[model samples]
Target chain A: MARYATTPSQTVGPYLHIGLPWPDGPFAVAEGTPEGVWIRGVLYDGAGAPVPDGLIETWQADPEGRFDHPDDPRGAVARPGFRAFGRCPTDANGEYGIFTLKPGPVPGPGGTLQAPHIDVSVFARGMLHRTVTRVYFPEEAAANAADPVLSSVPEPERATLVARPAEDGYRFDIRLQGEDETVFFDV
Target chain B: MSTDPTTRPAPPAYARDAEVHPPLDYPGYRSTALRHPKRGLRLLPHLLTEVTGPLLGEDRISENDSDLTRQHDGEPQGQRIIVHGQVRDGDGRPVPHTLVEIWQANAGGRYRHTGDNWPCPLDPNFSGVGRTLTDDQGRYRFTTIRPGAYPWRNHDNAWRPAHIHFSLFGRAFTQRLVTQMYFPGDPLFFQDPMWNSIPDEKARERLVARFDYANTAPEWALAYEWDIVLRGREATVFEDEVDED
Candidate 1:
């Protein structure tokens, strides 16, 4: 097997906000933009304690499942006014929020469509490497059932990937450990 | 129940101890199967077709936004210094116009954050957080006071070494990275678990910034340089492109 040496990841440390958050960082789009929802969640450490200073970043596609960059083998086409990427830093209460539109379905490995989901990466004090995971929209149950990525998750543990619906948007609490730990991916 | 990163071969720079990385192991890192790496990760794609960001410095940048050594009124106490370096890809090419953010404790080993109740005196002029975009050469420089070694409860009498945290973001989403740079010649290296966590001895040293006398102004602040290397992208691709075509 061929391998490429990659720079290893390190903890975000106690002062993560120094370098991660910015004045307009947490918005993937303007709040209250039509169809945009607030994706908010609190991060927890293994003892089931809130990690107040953690950093959460999410990346997704526009409503058409199209991208704005040249790497899209399809082409660099963006939905007008769609940012598709956002960064949110947790507050003292351990909650992080981002205002973004629901991501459209993207391609799976073998021509199948992934459910409307967002890629999430977490960085915190004790974590040497950021953990990777996905947040699927609960409302996309019909499409979620057919997603190649979601099906791969163990049946009983699959719900952990879906964010529960809330008053403003969706709530997905990420558990670093303990009962009902959030399902983190290796990537 | 192997806890190793199976998707990619362990980076040559990873720490020598298999379980020394506290975050990878649940409970220790977090005890739960959900914390364990499952097969689903293999199928995930980090790159989306549209994840690029536009230019950042196009607008006016205020002085207070990038300089942390001096805040509202008083200057942060410590050895006044300049932290500057380039952001490069693994290929050693500069990644210009990217954002680099940083935060650190004040020289008194105390943070301006609320969760910190360590009783250390706070610097009236220092909030210890600042950011700026890399220049066209992929170089980023900041003026800040050196952070002080602070105590943590990770172990008995655990004092983290004085260091500054760095966060970088490139055009694409997959291009983000977070790391820390330590001041050279700190006595706390051996005692710090986080420092020892990077198993590769050389990689461990890379985290430390070096003294740059030439860059230091004759009468002004001292200078330190610490460059960061990201993975994957070929930074030099722009070099060979022909605009005439």
Candidate 2:
């Protein structure tokens, strides 16, 4: 049998806005959805400078811990206004934002529970490939402590994964390099 | 019934053949030095989120979105070409009804973006962007002008090869891919960091599109074909991993 290898990834490049962005891409849930919160942050490089040409995408479950995808073993959940996905391009200041509701705890390996979190993928002009990361809620202390994925990360670096409370929702800045860099994933 | 958690195996994780992909910190690509993460990436289990993604299609795009040449009232300045291909998974199964988007420079090696202030003249009739949903057989086709090579400040007189940027959305988030499709036998490959970044020669070759004489429209336009393959899931059953994760 013939086997095909997966194609490699490349950077989104400087002019991604021409093709990638949708008018309503920042909204994971429909606009004006009750209790919807915004996840906003800036993408910084090792020099501590903002990356204006970057793009960020997010995926997460609904508050009920259910996904609208067919692959979910619990079966797919069809929510009227929940898309469960968000994509946003950075502004001139290199800041990106996504509006979504808090995700519920998800099942983890070994029957453990993962902390309520959002999966994130970052792309930019200079990057050869997108980098993967996760965003956990700051208030989920107990759940975060028991989470298998969170526990695997080194203590100091774990805090970088947790988002800080913001006025409208939560603020979780992503630093591609330098001190206090976010913990990226290899999923 | 078996209640042991161990009895339920984990779902197959996306294959991580590091050598097949470019390193995040390749210095040859000057921009990577300060932008690539310093710490190692932690392993993430393929839970529900990894195996599923948003299904984008018909609602977001239009009929003329696949034809870049006709988007504007007048024709763009360049050699008209038809680029087509099939979207498949690593297992070689066709991925139908998925979204594929592309953007590129004009014939003069200049982008339509405000940030692209290169000295080359911009085509007033070209936006250089197009998109479409794959057909039942995972096939997608586009009508556009062939782009030209452009100079960059990456190194002394750095010029990128003529290429089109591609973005694909497969069945799962893990299967998402973004890559550049280059013209076959371009002289710029040796000096371009982006082209040489891939460690595997065979993997690098996949990025080049092949000229198809059969697909060419006589007296109308030239044709090129390039197939894309996204990552495949592990061979494990969903039932085992759902409970374990």
User: By how many angstroms RMSD does model 1 differ from the true structure?
Assistant: 7.4
Q: Where is model 1 chain B poorest over a 10-residue stretch in terms of lDDT?
A: B9-18
Q: Write the per-residue lDDT of candidate 2 for residues B49-136, one digit (tens) a residue.
A: 7888888769878868999999988999999999999999876789999999999999998999989998999999999999899999
Query: DockQ for model 2?
Result: 0.59
The 10-residue segment of model 1 chain A with minimum total lDDT is: A1-10
Q: For residue A71, what is the lDDT in candidate 1?
A: 58
Candidate 2 clash pair list:
A107-B245, A108-B245
Clashes of 1: 10
Structural similarity to truth (TM-score) of each candidate: 0.82, 0.95
Give the top-scoring candidate (DockQ): 2
**Residue B210 of model 1: what lDDT?**
91
Candidate 1's DockQ = 0.36
